[model samples]
Target: MPEIRNILFVMYDQLRHDYMSCAGHPTMRTPNFDRLAAKGVRFTQAYVQSPVCGASRMSYYTGRYVGSHGAAWNGYPLKVGEATMGDHLRKLGMDSWLLGKTHMTPDTEGMARLGLTRDSVIGARVAECGFDLWVREDGLNPEGPDGFYYATPSPYNEYLKSLGYPGENPWHDNANAGVDEDGSVASGWLMKNARKGANVKEEHSETPWLTDRCLDFLASPQAAERPWLAHLSYIKPHWPYIAPEPYASMYGPQDVVPANRTEAEREDPQPVYGAFMNNLIGKAFSRDEVRSEVVPAYMGLIAQCDDQFGRLLDHLESTGRMEDTMIVLTADHGDYMGDHWMGEKDLFHDCSVRVPLIIYDPRQSAGSTRGTTCDALVESIDLTATFIEAAGGEVPEHVVEGRSLMPFLRGDTPAEWRDVAISEYDYSCSVMAGKLGVAPKDAVLFMIFDGRWKMMHAEGGFRPMLFDTLNDPKELDDRGDDPACAETRARLMERLSAWSRRVSQRTTISSDQIIARRGKARSKGVYLGVYDENDLTPELLVPITGAAKGDFR
Candidate 1:
């Protein structure tokens, strides 16, 4: 195979597959991503191996499952020595340039020490990756001058403020107004915007600049000759639930409001797991003052991302770089977006795990397969293999789990492709699932989605919940107890069991050991959070003083 010249990867922070036009989303309009899908292979059923941001990203970058790498959750570091895609690509003589957030913590000092006020992505232990350049932040969200909906000012926070919002805003808290089928808003104040269309292009906002920087890097002479890799990670559609005018009103709250819960759904046994229900949103918005306008603003935010993405694509095409470049557009994971009464992405349901995965192979096809959606199961881990293979490099022998999607991207699905995809979480293992019956014990919840059959096996609370996704796409009903679905459940369980064993072998950290090592770190006053494997949010954690790093562990 000939060497591929350039690799362009665009990963959104928290994007849901159902929100993309190419993924059967009739209401959302993402022309650029949609266009890419038209010409390339679209994995209709793509899921993150790990549900959260850091863990899922680790899986993709390392070509290993999250369980294999010890960075099980956010705020945690990957084991001291792990080979990343950047490392492997560099070995093949590729000049890797990371444009935006990589989510990896730079050093033990954390964000504050690296000239970062918030969680910016920095690859501290990425020495082996051999990236030529990394324009990274510690966390995924970029702080603008305007600050987030309810945040204070800082280097990153000021970026949000410059966009024209109060200096202290926390849009991430909860502003999801529950939308009814008839288009009436019931819960959030996302619509509480003083100025809309006029300020969308505010200079301080980071999205525009992130794109600009990426373009600048792409245009550089070095990129053309070295076969560079650039990951344009955008922070839009992630929070504040506010959008500039016109777009804020582009889709009326009534126009874009998707399916809601029914009375029967309210009574769902798996209510805790359902998406787009009042029970979920109610948690975020009990105050009536700011409830009704949240959805509209949130919709507008997504439109902004789509628009920026289009601009980036246009620039690539205009520069004559679109044809030779291999573009992969997807997200780290999905967001609940007021679904099932939830606001962020820290769950195991499709709302948090299934994301849009579009691979555009400019060398092989372009606009050749418009509207073609492949239903094959694909996980984020495959990306490492796909990129290596696409760049005419060898897939690392250490990463044995991921299957390259190149064959499928070329419209060839080998007979051995797996039919099911699995995801997991280990944060609340002891509380959610019983401690694995072993020393230094931990619990885990494993999920398997195979076509219409979806099984969630927990260690404790719920032994296992099964859903026929086709019959109940919303997953309102649990068929685990129904005798008729026994065979289906059994088949899924077998897969789950096999996956469980595989994960066991791949387990990177023993809960006891992490606590011990982290305990010393925490005593020194470093803010720490434990992200669950399935859910990125810290389940059980302690905040150490942001005091000196040496003061703590």
Candidate 2:
């Protein structure tokens, strides 16, 4: 019976669901995350719509599938006029604000064609992927031969320069790199440099900086005016694979278990599988030395993330903001880190597509399910619908493909729910696609997880990749060609085909409005397939017989 005053959706970049101590990580401990899970339902099975950042985040913001929104990869712009969480929450008197990275590339061309400028409110929301960005830093600003990965002279670089750090790109030179004994900069892009401590201090690092920004937002006059959905997205524990101070040396090579791979996976691999295994990033991570140097740093970054998040939680409780605020902790997706001979996410393995989803609903109904783990299938996009519902608004069925998780939070079993979870990827823009000689239009991949057997459907005539996740929990074995799995494969293929045919394009109007407007056209004096006036129903003909409706033609 308690009312929801605000929401905080926290997304950590590249955090694996299993890496959390509550989720069974042997080494990493996230006590603050554990505290949140203890007060709410922890979903053991949560899948994102895509394995990559931009596409998956678009799904989270829009509450639609990848195919529905059409922003398929990073740097790919989310088209203008999509109904996003901000649009929905704004209608319900809740403001949606962004604190950190969204990986959003504004649809500049689309906005230009529509005569929209970023200076306007509607245009600014669309430009930021439907959120009022308070501070946005993607946190990875590598300079390639062509140009920088993101805009040069970013806010983060300025902040570092303000703190007395030298150089044009302090973000890369100091924050992500270290000084060797020779006094030269060691770039962290290479795994060999990961063990070295970054030049920046822990207090000024990315995660801690973002946490400070969150505190600033909470104390701002705008946040105090009304209810808000704060998307405190952190770009950390992702790449550059370096940490500052004690965090870089906290864990060693011995702490990490061996990378999850096998020699059998290399021999006679599938076309797409072999392509990814031999790709640029893939081969680098395949080396044992690379995995050894990188995993420790990766683990340390996750530790930093845990500490920073716990810091935010402490501030919330001290300010008494946790009483009516619903908080959701999740990730865009996870990194592979040499798993399946892959360096980064692009596959459908649990290491890639699955993410941590923990929600704390500070309401009386949620108390019964507190500290409980839910094995029910959950999707990242579902948070959009859940946020809308928490704001006391109904989800627009035609627009949002994700269902609300509120029923689960209330300790009630929904009478109906989806039987399978879905994830998709468009690798046409990836170098791996070129290695396979795949056409741009045919480089898509889809994953269907039915709570047991998972099937990865590849385009361009590549056969489906199947894995018995329950029996072979590590997913090292690919049962795609096994004759015994033909039945399961066919069933999943049928399900995939059915999912493809969903009503994904009709976003302007809600299905409820359609149902409510049913049969009203004829009553408003428009008639169809009537051979004579007598053929129509008496009620329908009342308008036709009226002086206003008759013989106008």
Candidate 3:
């Protein structure tokens, strides 16, 4: 059994847990993802700490909850002092490199306050959410009223231009938006444009391009190290949801699954949930015409993503590195796709929060778990601990809040594990919060799911939301306000409260350090700290008793 020498952490943006055929998707077939699952463990109950991009990725990178990391939304900066997976792996002589998106917003304010310059190596790494960038691209280069979404030129756009897709922003034309016969941009953001294929060559698409970039990195001399973590983050199966060539027409509206919504859900919805349902984006998804036009494109993007995964997998096998590297396929978060009448992922619904987690660990110890499914509750942040442990590094419990899945990968169930999966969202940074008249701090929501029951707690004096997922598998029913479910709601709330009060901030020091310093004050001649002479050594007590004052002096 060779030790797991490297990590290929592949993440797709807005990929739902059930979209893969292996996860029981009735229409979408992701054979490549299924292959990975067959070769390793597929987690049935994996969730992210937050359902949005930046905050969720930060939680995965830092192994901390959103509250602990203090990054509540996309573009929110992860604080400077928090330790990330890169920081942990580096301590064990492994380098963590980023090949694509991290969705990380640099802590510019923290950097300025601490006098950290981005030009410095430490500063650069800090700015990248603790990764050494090997071609960093957040992938979305959408032009808006304020210029591009990122307000900077994209390297991908430059690459597209080099490939003869001439324009200042080919990212919008060839990569994202489709081009009409009149050469006008068919913006993918529009539902009607989803019916058309992207104008880019299939090979030049973002998914394939990012895969090539990863392959190039692997072939590079610098990546010859036996141990490294390469985060191959792809921006796809996300919005601007057009696919290229064959993928565009691969799935039709006929394959689109019916949305998990009902008039019953709309009636007497919780205040926060109601606000999201009425959000502009949510309203768009609520229309049947929009869903009919957009869902096929969404499916096409995922199919393309799966095809790219196959390419990467084939490359690894061809290079004979497949047996040595651990491959983890997951997503930052899941898209709502009109589920619960939502367009994006800003809620705690399963479609929005749960994500597919397939881990292919080639170690001999993982043989028993191969092709097996683990139903244990897990979080996206758990990958940090799993990676550290797989690399033969100690799991820093104080710094990382997630439990390692190494035991499950080794075909062993943990003696005890978390019964519930938690997710959070802070909508204050979103337009929906303003429309709802809720303050930033009060606009936050937390979800706790114990498999059977899912509970949502919103701040700002909003009502709680409860779902008996065992009965309403689609989460169509809200039992939070039901008088019959009062006891169930209270119990779940207690669990959430307990989880929130955990010792999350004692990250700099371990419990062993505190224990080691238990009686140090008395040993340092602080006599008041000791209740009796036995509490201190005789030599120390003699000096403290003034019996050997001259010697002590």
Candidate 4:
């Protein structure tokens, strides 16, 4: 097998796992995604640590669970000094660069306490989730009466203005919002304008713009100097469901898949689930006309994303870098898209939690596994471990809770892989928590999926939610409160309890390092049970006796 040198870590926001043609979307065809999948291993049951973007992406970067990292919601800063992809890769002489969204807020308070300014490289990396930036754009630069979402002017919006795009914020007005013929701005934030074409040209939209920047970086001299991990994160197929130009009109109601929900799901829904179902986003998507108008636009954005990936793949092939570079195409978290009477991601539905994961490892050893689909339970943090190993370094197991997928890539099953896939959600920031009258600390939810049954455990005294993935694939029926499933619920709850007790906080030292340092105190002259000099080995007392000619005691 040839050495894996570079990693093109690509991510699309809110891309459902089942949307790609390779993943079996009957109407929406993703030729580029299928092309990558054919040359790699596609994971059918890949799950994220969190359902929301910020928390999920932080899990991807940090290689740890949400509970371990503590960045449990959007805008919640990942603690300073948290180990990320770059932190692991740097030790192996690999550089990690960011081209798009991380949704990572800077840990200003932690940095200030440590007297580390963001201007310094170390501090800057800490602020940027351990990656040096080529162009760091989190893509949502909305401005309101309160203030701007971004502290500074967004680089993407500035690029739009330079190209003669009219408006103060072309990112919001042009790329995200649709301009009606009558000269009114139809904000994409409102799902009603989703059927209309975006105000900007196809090339000027977020997907293409970020793709062009990524190509420039890949072609640059700096990129050629060393192996690097380019996190080319595209902020598309997420919200603002507006696609520019031809992509906007590519699909319509005919191509829209029926929402996988039923009226039965609404009957006696769990309290927290009921809150989300009653929310604005949920209620809007619950209507048939809204799904007809919005899903096509959502599909169009994904189609555009696949086209952009085609450009990336072609560039790598032409440059002869495909042989050595590993490409991973995945979403931070899947969008619910009105699945199970809910819109936007949160909760444990497969539509939201199970993201599409395609990994193309350009190595001879991985050739046999190409074009195969692996059903082993994979987590978002596993990519972090895979990258560390591919970059010629071992995974810091104590820090990275996820196991590497390299074994799967090499066509081998792990001796003891995990049976359950876990995901967490922090609803303290959501309106659902307030509606439920739950305190911030108790506004949490956990999921444990063991291939057959899916169980959701909510805090604040709510009953467990259960879904039989084998029997009820669409999860229309909630077996959560069903007394018949008591044994299954208890078994899954025990798995969750075992997972929560894992050694997640002691990350600075590895288990192997601790093992090597075991019984090391004796060599350093602190033998606790030594009755006399004869009680210890002569060599072990060298630290004391071999010191200055004084009493060995």
Query: What is the C-alpha lDDT profile of model 2 across 10-98, one tens digit per residue?
Result: 99999988888888888877788898898888999999999999999999999999999999999988988788999999999999999
Q: Please provide TM-scores, in order, for all candidate models, with all chains considered together.
A: 0.74, 0.96, 0.96, 0.97
Candidate 4 per-residue lDDT, tens place, 187-279, comes to: 998888997899888888999999999999998987999889999998888888988879889999999888898888898998988999889
lDDT assessment of candidate 2: 0.91
Residue 259: error of model 3 in Å?
Answer: 1.5
Single out the weakest 10-residue window by summed lDDT for candidate 1: 169-178
Model 2 poorest ten-residue lDDT run? 543-552
Scored by lDDT, model 3 comes in at 0.89
Angstrom error at residue 349, model 4:
0.2
Shift of residue 279 alpha carbon in model 3, Å = 1.8
Tens digits of per-residue lDDT for model 3, 387-506: 899888889899999989999999888889998899999889777788779987798999999999999999988889988988898888888888999999889999999998899999
Q: What is candidate 1's lDDT per residue for 120-149, written digit by digit as tens? A: 333433521324444664323333567442
Per-structure clash totals for the candidates: 58, 0, 0, 0
Total backbone clashes of model 4?
Answer: 0
Q: In model 1, which regions exceed 4 Å deviation?
A: 1-3, 106-133, 138-200, 266-282, 285-292, 365-371, 429-443, 503-553
